[model samples]
Target: MFTGIVEELGEVTRVEPGDGVTRLVVRGPVVTGDAKHGDSIAVNGVCLTVVELSGDEFTVDVVPETLRRTSFDGVEPGRRVNLERAMAANGRFSGHIVQGHVDGTGTFLSRDHDGLTHFAYPPELSRYVVEKGSIAVDGISLTVAEVTRDEFAIALIPTTLAATTLGRNEPGDAVNLEVDVLAKYVEKLAAVHLPSAAVDNGGGEEDR
Candidate 1:
């Protein structure tokens, strides 16, 4: 598991497409400093296992399913991606629990002058987002400053803008999004006591 804390703004050095898997090589000195084979690394919020390591670069194979569900479907070389190694068992938990599993993708809609960035998320994810709740956008955990029926906003500090890929995001660019896993767990646990149809069908008033 990851903490949704970006340790390096890595560069994608190569993307080699194959029959069923795409090989991705990324350059991240900090994350690769002590990396080994089979270690998991969160690349742009998607947990990918390192299959090979060379110098400061590591390669991971991205399958079709991962590409379809993430912003990496047609990801190209030279793209800047957030990178974080799996959190150490003894490490401090600085950020919220992040699985590095992209639930879906969101669109970068706009950014206000004061760094209040707005994003349009899939409607299915709306119930999982709340004002002041934690959300992971491209692997960088951020607090939801506001939420609407179709979108949410985040007040990005200078540090976030400088440290993560959000700084370079364009208006129409797609971003990987992972809502708080605890919220999903709560919904699942609550479903047992609440009406089954409402929860099972995922069609009811927001659970809050």
Candidate 2:
């Protein structure tokens, strides 16, 4: 599990294609300081297991499914990605629980100088987003500022604008998005206990 708190900004050094898995070499000094084989590192909100280690650089294999589901399909050498080590057992949970599993990808629509950023997402994932709920964008935890039928916005603090990949992306760029897992659980539980609420299929009621 992760806390969606970015530890370092890492760069993809190389991408090697193989039969079953694609290898990605990334450079992260802080997150890889004591990293070893089989250790887990989150690259751009995707949980990747360290396959090999070389000083500050480590290799992780991406399956085809991951590429299809995440923005990693467009990842290339020299791309900067958000990096975070798995939360330690005693680590403080400053942010919400992040599985490093990107539910889907969203496109950056626009942002205001006042720090409100809007993103256009796939319509299918719209049910998962909620105003004021926690969401992870590129692995950084943020609260939903508002929601539209197919898009959502977040209020970014200066620290968020300066610390992670969100600072670098422009309009039309794809970003990895993971909605709160708790919300999904709630939906599933509600389906069993509150059939009327589940009949809405997690979109909730707009008019009521």
Maximum-lDDT candidate: 1
Record all residue pairs in model 2 with backbone atoms less than 3 Å apart, i.e. clashing: none
User: When superposed on Cα atoms, how far off is each prediction in RMSD?
Assistant: 3.8, 4.9
What TM-score would candidate 2 get against the native? Answer: 0.92
Q: Taking the tens digit of each residue's C-alpha lDDT, what string does model 1 give over 1-208?
A: 9998899899999999999999999999999999999999999999999999999999999988888888998989999999999999999999999988888899999998999999999998998999999999999989999999789999999899999999999999999999998998889878879886767545533211
Error of 1 at 189 (Å): 0.8
Cα lDDT listed for each candidate:
0.92, 0.88
Candidate 1, position 153, lDDT: 98
lDDT of 2 by residue, 1-208 (tens): 9999999999999999889888999999999898989998989898899999999999999998888888988678999999999999999999999988888889998889889999998887787898998999988889999998789999998888888998888899999988898977777767756757444555532210
lDDT at 144, model 1? 97
Runs of candidate 2 exceeding 4 Å displacement: 194-208
Error of 2 at 204 (Å): 21
| Candidate 1 stretches greater than 4 Å from native | 201-208
